[model samples]
Target: KLRIRTPITTRMTGCPNGCARPYVAEIGLVGNGPNMYQLWLGASANQTRLAWVFQERMNLDDFERTLEPIFIEYKKSKRRAESFGDFCDRAGKEELERVVNEFDPSQSLVKTTAKPRVSVTTETMDRLTRISDIRGLSPSKLANEILEQYIDSLETTVHAQK
Candidate 1:
């Protein structure tokens, strides 16, 4: 179904030995257990980079249902005649992960809990409160926004260095 609906190659194996060359396939599935596999994606076109495992485990029965929506996005939004490897590269891992998240059959498998309270110096807390008040947001939300921006900048810097 994956090959029929999308122009990407998929390779699967029944064990972690990776004999199927899942590292180079557009969609790599290495078995984790009976009827279960670990999913990977974003291998470079030249096979210079191995795919990254995004899902640690998933049932084979969930494949089509989970991946079809992602293929639909690729079909509707990709450049004309772009191969899945190139499309995955162009879309970037984060965006593709967002598409995959929509069809996650194990959504409820993850336990959701309120974020734990973070420890901060009194000065930092006061500053955050003041900035958040001016921005019309809760202190926690403002702090999250600030952290996300910092992480983005840090990631860009780290990637640039490498």
Candidate 2:
């Protein structure tokens, strides 16, 4: 017999920037505020990885009230020892969207605004050039590496404090 384990874990408050690797969990509830949450679902160890943002800015009270029924349905229909991610893959995105819409009716049809591009001035370019020369790398390559490291460090610091 294959024994399955399901545990509900909690993180006080944090952002999902892959620093904490929240997408690896079966059910991840991220705090958006005092009483708001963003629910992440269907993450697993298999390479078939995708975590859908089920709800955004959902009131914690509302989430608690709504989650039980959905979970019950999953439990009832789940295959013998099928993981949450497997179940979600089998269920498909449309069904997941339907489930989420039932909880938060006012689904934002609007797409997220794209981040404004940072124009690289001469001063910025010169600084990047100097760093690249010192590191023996091309300016473009150095810039990319620097940006990646900077973002990772920022996320780590932010999560550490939380």
Candidate 3:
């Protein structure tokens, strides 16, 4: 589990069906119910390993309390541009547990589900699958928008002619 991260991204999900695929996310949180989430970490982005359960049945307050100190320690411990999942894998379970146990939740600043969800082009999805990485945003949104503008312009010209 000490290998380098193949991708650099994060994700979140509110679906019980695991729509966000938290099982393989570097930092994945699945919503169990109102204000309750399950935390998973140390997953390889390339789907090489399913993430381990770092914590379960966490409330917003608990999420904040549990994650902040680990983040701080990661900041101190990580190599250049290393990701959370990669850091988690290299740090090992015992060390992560030690950090989790030591962190005081009172100091947490962001105490809720905080990762972004984005849509992408099918082409982008294909590239992601090919590359073993998950960049959160999609280039297709922009492409679709521009295509709409072009269509509108064409329609305007046809309408004027008619």
Candidate 4:
């Protein structure tokens, strides 16, 4: 396991429909085919910026091997308290690509990338907190109910449109 200076956000989706909001994550992996994914990087930790495409079709099997060098450089050269996403933004995609391409696996620092997790937007979380407090319900329960309601509404709208 590699230790990072600050928490990094990672999102993975089965498709490129932005369902997981991968575009706003520091490390976004959108599955394009079996065992192949589109890699995105450079978004802010706060989800305020959009991550750009680092690779159109990276082999998922090579995920750790491909990112180890960049992770090493970030760990060694990043400014104090800088996050992985912030470091990626400052380093720029071209330079990061070069580092990845020129990396020697024999000099690997550590293996593995962070496991991906689903997350709600900050705004949604805040809203949930407020509404849950007023209704005396748990924030997670409220969030789930809201999501289910929203999905139902979307389905109704789609059926109406058709």
Give the C-alpha miss distance for residue 51 in model 3, angstroms: 1.3
lDDT of 3 by residue, 1-162 (tens): 223343644667998687878888888888878878888888876768778878777886576667777777777798887777878988987899899898766655554556555667888768655544344445455445556899999999999999
lDDT of each: 0.76, 0.64, 0.74, 0.87
- TM-score ranking from best candidate downward: 4, 3, 1, 2
lDDT of 4 by residue, 1-162 (tens): 567647889999987789999999999999999889999999999888899999899997688877788888898889988878889999999899999999887777655555554588999789889999999999977877887999999999999999
lDDT of 2 by residue, 65-162 (tens): 44553564466677887776667667765786666457443432323344344569999999999989999999988878988999999999999999
State residue 74's C-alpha deviation in candidate 3, in Å: 0.8
Q: 22-77 in candidate 1: lDDT tens per residue? A: 98987899999987989887776567767887678878766765566567667767
Off by over 4 Å in 4: 109-162
Q: Which portions of model 3 miss their true places by more than 4 Å?
A: 1-8, 104-162
lDDT top scorer: 4
C-alpha RMSD values across all candidates = 17.9, 16.2, 12.0, 13.5
Compared with the true structure, the alpha-carbon lDDT of candidate 2 equals: 0.64
Better of 2 and 3 by TM-score: 3
Candidate with the larger lDDT of 3 and 4: 4
What TM-score goes with each of the models?
0.54, 0.49, 0.55, 0.65
Residue 45 miss distance in model 2 (angstroms)? 4.5
Superposition TM-score, candidate 3 onto the true structure? 0.55
By lDDT, the candidates rank as: 4, 1, 3, 2
